[model samples]
Target: MQYWRKPLDADKIQVPHGEIHIVRDRCKGCGFCVEYCPRDVLELSKQFNIKGYHPPEAVLPEACVHCQLCEMLCPEFAIFVTLREEVETIES
Candidate 1:
């Protein structure tokens, strides 16, 4: 089965800078998000969250491409990706 490769227009396929979010309380520490993120943006840590499990961390925020695949694959739905506002450049 063929799949969408993300639209190409700058408006629809914008490569916006983005960030990752981890819901500390809801994470189950199953490592599902850590393993599935294509960009390898997440990592398992020795530190634990309020729920007592070692929640996933955004170890490499710069590596994220805002694909949202990890967020969709997470069983607990505790992960989210937020796009940062583009910094408009001024040309002299």
Candidate 2:
């Protein structure tokens, strides 16, 4: 997205990141999570799960913004997202 002017605190503000977890066997090949993701983060996997259903995989894991939309939309409760923690290292 382009803007004429950037936000004054843009540099100071941090965008929340997320990690997506998918329970392959629990998925019913429903594309609800993939279809409803606002960031287009997930996609239907070509590989089939234990139940003979193509589960969702994170195609763009880094793009997740911790919105939890995929978790909410999933009918089978197969997917969920956790906030990615940022760790800083210090050198003595």
Show model 2 residue runs off by greater than 4 Å. 1-5, 87-92
In model 2, the clashing pairs are none
Question: What is residue 74's positional error in candidate 2, in angstroms?
Answer: 0.7
What's the lDDT for residue 29 in model 1? 92
Q: Tell me how candidate 2 scores on lDDT.
A: 0.84
Badly placed stretches (over 4 Å) of model 1 are 1-14, 87-92
10 residues in a row with least lDDT, candidate 2: 83-92
Residue 68 lDDT in candidate 1: 87
Candidate 1 lDDT, 18-80, residue by residue in tens? 588888788889998888887777899888888899888888886677788878888888888
Q: 20, model 2: CA deviation in Å?
A: 0.5
Report clash pairs, candidate 1. none
Query: How many clashing pairs per prediction, in order?
Result: 0, 0
